[model samples]
Target: MQLKKLILLVTVLAGSYTLMAQTDKNSIDDKQNESQKKIKKSKTQLKDAEANFLLNYYEQDGDHSPVTGGRGTEKLENVAPTFVVHIPLDTVSNLDLNFGIDFYTSASTNNIDYFEGRKTGASGKDVRSHINAAYSRDLRNSGNAYSLMAGFSAEFDVTSFNFGGSYTINSKDKNRSLSLDALYMNDSWKLLYPYERRSDGTNWLKDDKRTTMKFGLSYSQVINKRLQALFSAEVVSQTGLLSTPFHRVFFDDVNGIPYDNLRSFSHVEMLDDNRLKIPVSMRLNYYLNDFMRLRTFYRFYTDSWGITAHTASIELPIQITPSLIASPFFRYHTQTSADYFYEFGQVSKAMVDAKETQFYTSDYDLSDLSSTKIGLGLQYSPLLGVGRFKSPFVKNKQVQFKSIGLRTAFYDRSDGLNAWLVSLDFAFTF
Candidate 1:
């Protein structure tokens, strides 16, 4: 069924693109004439609109599974496909649309029914779909622009609605800029608990809503012809139902009560419902001669739950040929654990008895950890098209192949988890 759904989705997207291409071909002449008239009235001319498509695949395997009290299978796989379209409404206004879907399966999520006495547990696959639309307008040629966006996401057990806006101001020479953005989201979830813990199967969650608000500010400056820098800061706050209901927590001292079909006694995970997060980051890029460039990034993050993290990364892009580029990158990150975090089957009776420390979790993701990732990528883009062929259905309309890219990466964590990923991207233009 999932494969069928994926195939149907791809077919619909392809059909839509074909229809759009035909429509654009039919209206090209009218649009060109209209654009010429607008250009004659204004000094600045509009550029051609563009559309892009991207597809990604990822898989991972690890031994720690939070659903099994942080020590079981943590295998997962995911595939995502996305499409973006940008249209110029006028010389100073534009509209953008993005649509995406993700299909994922997790062995850890399947452990929610581990006690059901099944060899592999129940199905843990789900599909998520989302769309975003935005409109941006230049207030004036003097370097002021504003944009507004709305987005929605839906999955089997969760739905989210988001709204956001951004304002940007650029210096006269366009070498310096500042941007401010604000966003709000409302997420609703159908809380599903572990099979053995659901008392009345129907009475899963009393409150299943989460609300988040975020604000961001950024500044970019061009220091010289070859160097540029950007700094950004963000504040995020979330409230209500922040913990996963299905994740289990085991105590060191068992109370002689045995869980059904399981060797260890476990309870549903619990934690505080409110959290606040702040992150600040900076990026620097340098162009060296005509064949090489360097990019560096650093970030510091902290949260009210007593977690602190640091991240740093660097990438170097080298031009192998006029039409080919190679980039290699590495990143490192480390974080302090949340105050209420405990290992699998390691929670003490004293901590459980104390009301203040009752808000605890055995989720490894909230524990102290260090991680590293390294990757390489190659891109091929020709300066001039090899050739262009007219569309069979639209007279005088031609399309050209643009570029291709391939990337692979390896990720390792201090907590005995590792993963590898590879991806390919292709682009075309009309």
Candidate 2:
């Protein structure tokens, strides 16, 4: 009887152990299924993608053409079209692509090949295209974001490639933020000289490479519900050819006789190849009411070439209706001339003869000047889609128009330069 009791006790203990093992296994399976469901839900919450298109037309007319020793028509026209797309990779990452093309015609550029000593400016046209791609990701619930970008630009005589990255950190409350960015660019140029400076077949510029580096830091804060502000500072360094090859600089001889009939014959521009630049800026936005806002900006800039500049701008935006907004803006900018800048007929005969002046530029662009720009813009964005179109190649795929904007600006410079620009922008989503 004692032996039977012992066998029964062993069987009961073994059965209890097996049942506990099965329960633990089932618990693990349930935990894994719940974790997978959470992950799927997070992925499905990704945001929708968007796209934008912009077109601009600009025209300018002035009498100071640098290529002609700063004494001819500076007429130019430009048309630029740009496209941008934003795509969400997942719940915490996104990708952006941007492409743009600019077609321009400049009367000043035509002066590089002045015709038979004639004063008539040449008509020069060229095209420039650029593309940029970027990827950005948000840290896992940390309110930190990081981005990397690469870009390339190409033109008839110039090509440049750039790479950059930025990081942003936000406060726990999300009302304050800081950002840092760095960029590097490599540029190659095909040197083309003024008609008079080029010997029968010899090139003027032997070295045509340039490199640039930039660093930036910024901070943004919200002081109150109606006021927000941001501050930014940047440093830029550049090395190699900074002067335009075709810009003509005329000099007077001891006899006061201008070289080459003061028309076609002259020396090209020369300047320091290395430069450093620093700029600091601030922006403030004030929300006056549900329908009105004010934006203001100011910047201070200084450079190694002895140039100092200041810029100030203000804009007021008013919501005319639920679907319409109007904004008017004004900007003022002033800058001191570079140490080497010389206006037309301003260079002395002694300086020309000594040839000791290490730096000299007859380019008016480097001269002291003040400018003002006034602009007006209108934007239309309805709560409901304004229009939609189905893609012929993709079934059940449609694109909707979200908003449209138009802007026009008039620019005037103290140095007799003036311009007008009009731009149109459209936003869409799929």
Candidate 3:
């Protein structure tokens, strides 16, 4: 009896010790997991509020001004300034604000009073202003995110309002992502007709409002450690006043022609009331070395107006130093003419009067053309930023001058149009 009791006691003690050991192991594992999660959260949280300022100067010159019936100078200059800000609402949410203004002068628009031989004044210059706001949030630990946006823009001739939303899903490993977005825009025009055609006492347009809808889907993937790619597709639909009220179209027939010293016959541009467009694009990036990267892009576009376009571009970004980068890029684009697009004096007035066609336009933008753009961009950003200053709005805080960027480009079109653009950008963190 004594031997049996001793054996039972030993067995019970061993079993109890084993159970205690397992419980301690589980507790340690739970604490370790909780600590790791905290570390990750801390690393992912936003640390500062960011802001950017941008300034741009653009100028263009070309022939074939639609305002002058596609046979005059098309010279324009513009200065634009934009500001952007991003604020962290929480660990997983952010708010973004963007505002911009554009000041422009156009010789083509000045021609509105050319027929009357009046001096171009306010008709040649205009200002446009725009503002946009967005809010975005991420679903914690779910790899899902969403954003909502609203914007408005106004100018002397038109006002536009837009609203949009986007949803994104990322893979658990963060190597792949898919995004979907949709937007709607409404534009209202003042119907500013040309100087010579204003008193014709005719209702030239059916509606002064235009509506546009866009939907897009994009997918990005990390093919390998050295390569990444993105594919995107979009569908766009537009309705209402699709033609410019002030653009003039000339015809070949008698009523559209001229006698000795007579002015060429012209009418307002016309187009379909509704249109549809589809575009697909792809971007590929390859890490060539520690100091250089290659980025390539291609796009195919088609529309219901009998137009098709293709675009291809390549860029090489070189790391000049730890804090500096330089990128040189080239782009080429080609497009077929729209079905209703006619050059200067290509369409006959009698054919239109006889109802041979329902739509016609002399706008060079709708004509078959090819274009090339080449540019270089430089950026400089230091490890701790270029400098720091005390925050004006927040006490006991500092703002850092994060980076500066400069970009310049030259663009040329197959049809006698050429343009130059230069822009500067500055970034700050508070």
For all predictions, the C-alpha RMSD in Å is: 8.9, 21.1, 19.9
The local lDDT score (0 to 100) that residue 260 gets in candidate 2 is 45
The TM-scores of all predictions, comma-separated, are 0.85, 0.86, 0.88
- Consecutive 10-residue window with the lowest summed lDDT within model 1: 26-35
Scored by lDDT, model 1 comes in at 0.69
Candidate 2 scores a C-alpha RMSD against the true structure in Å of 21.1
lDDT of 2 by residue, 1-430 (tens): 1111111111111001100100010010000000001113455587657787878787778887777777778788778787878888998888888788778878877667674464455557888787778888889778899888777777777787777788999999989999987777777877877776775666555569877787889899999999999998888888887777777776553135553465444767778899888888899999899888898998888889888888888988888887778888888888899898887667665775688676777765668988888888888877765688985546998887878888888888898878887888787777
lDDT of 1 by residue, 127-232 (tens): 9888878888887757799888777778877777777788999999889999988777778877877777785565534568877787888899999999999998
Instruction: Tell me the spans in candidate 2 whose CA falls farther than 4 Å from its real position.
Output: 1-44, 115-122, 200-206, 254-260, 263-265, 352-355
Global lDDT of each candidate = 0.69, 0.70, 0.73
- Name the best candidate (by lDDT): 3
Q: Candidate 2 — worst ten consecutive residues by lDDT sum? A: 25-34
The digit string of per-residue lDDT tens for model 3 on 1-430 reads 1111111111111001100100010010000000001123475666678897878787778888777777777787778787878889888888888788778778887876566765343337778787778888888879799888877777777787777788999999999999988777788888877766777767788899978787889899999999999998888888998888888877776344442222335578889989898888899999899888898998888889998888888988888887888888888888899999888878877788899998998777778988888888888877767799999999999998888888888888898888887888888889
Q: What is the lDDT of candidate 3?
A: 0.73
Candidate scoring better on TM-score of 1 and 3? 3
